[model samples]
Target: MKVSALGNEIAGPGGPGPGVRLVVVIEDEAIVLAGYQMLFESWGYVVIAAQSADEALGMLEAGSMPPGFILADFRLRDGQTGTEAIERVRQAFGPDIPGVVVTGDTTVTVDRLRLAASEGMPILHKPVNGRQLQELLTRSFKT
Candidate 1:
């Protein structure tokens, strides 16, 4: 277990530990992934990082409960999009699990937009600030 800069104790694996929330983040880029992990942990969430949908599923199947929410990159390696990924996760968990897709690619394809809308998931543009993410989460989970 490690302590945050603010001195909150983080437990092993499924953590920020008791009473803290959980958020799973999918981003293929290593540096970007690390930044988000740190950011969410700092926000007092147990942040699970995954490079792809399969990896995230594997982690979930390995016995961790579904997260409170999900944040995924719009475009992942091998052409897999975040909308589909989020859909799969929601299917496994529950439709109530709020998900947000983040993308550096400004271009929003019609298909992607429709998919996101159909699932009731929001797509936030990349360079998504910490405050933006925090606000979105607060609005979604009311926590």
Candidate 2:
């Protein structure tokens, strides 16, 4: 799965790599969000950070820049699950937008996997590597 196939313009700040035009990251952990944002921005992807599902939804509803990819934490603040947030985003943005769930919860069951599969979304375990995140975003854009 090449990142280019996902409709991302491979133009980073330095005009290097496949430039991802926009990406939304929904995570409760500020530190984690900062890390992801920094990495993606360094690679030239326009990154949008949200501390909660509600904030992310607000951004989308406000017609803030559309994102080519979405990365969410399975657990969130205000008792909202990542799956719920993803559902809302999918409904609002349509299924063409790719989504990925990155979580520390290894207890995800078969039913959860099935649900994610049904939505054509992938779930990645936490402590995600930079390469893995890149790969997930690339694959998502392609799908």
Candidate 3:
């Protein structure tokens, strides 16, 4: 679904036009995914969202435009993790596609931190506001 900066619905599906920055959001929570989509759209970004990595991959056509950024919940409905989801999507697009993992799991072990660090994905605690997300995007992608 496409939403304009003014929060109006836009026609057409699939990838966006040339030079349009897209953000792919993977969140199991319907409310959270909708919120992210609205927030990103309000920021003038084209958002392609799904509840899981597999679902997102299925929705995206082969050889379609790749997203400029990715956001996924650290813990999904299944045993799949955000890192795994990111890797799966990255494989479809390219390894350079930057992504972030959001999670409410406060007990982040050292091993988990190491894993995220190795993948160059920053983890944001849950209840993330628009400001924090915007700042992180700015710092990471200079958007």
Candidate 4:
């Protein structure tokens, strides 16, 4: 559901104009997605919520608008993982684009988790905190 007040206007020869920030969220749960859409937007970020990896990829294929950041759920429908979803989005957007994976999987291995952290891909456990998300987003845009 659309909630962000980030109105889209045709940019010049490039994409969104300066000061325009977009956050793409990949989630399957309708209620959760809605909550996140509103939450991020409240922080002044333009948020887009995708229901699945395929849907996100489809939007990219169809030339959907690019995002400055991505937030995705690790365990998704059809057995797809959040890592895979983020990878595909980065491939389409850019490698430097910052993203975070939200999951409740306690069984995630340490090495993998460390790798994510080192790469600056924060792994946020479920029931994501608004403050943490704000801090992360603040830090992400700084770089």
- Top candidate, metric lDDT: 3
- Ranking of all candidate structures by their TM-score, best first: 3, 1, 4, 2
Candidate 3 C-alpha lDDT tens digits along 1-143: 54433333433554567777777788988888888988887888777778889877765553268777889999998789898899999998889888999999987787997898789788888888779888766564564
Give the TM-score of each candidate.
Answer: 0.82, 0.76, 0.84, 0.79
Instruction: State how far residue 87 of model 1 sits from its true place (Å).
Output: 1.0
Off by over 4 Å in 2: 1-20
At residue 76, candidate 3 shows an lDDT of 90
Q: What lDDT does the true structure give each of the candidates?
A: 0.76, 0.71, 0.78, 0.75
Report lDDT (Cα) of residue 91, candidate 1: 87
Candidate 2 or 3, higher TM-score? 3
For model 3, where is the 10-residue window of minimal lDDT? 2-11
Model 1 worst lDDT window (10 residues): 2-11
Superposed model 1: Cα runs more than 4 Å off? 1-18
TM-score of 4: 0.79
Pairs of residues clashing in candidate 2: 6-141, 9-19, 10-18, 10-19, 11-19
Q: In lDDT terms, how accurate is model 4?
A: 0.75
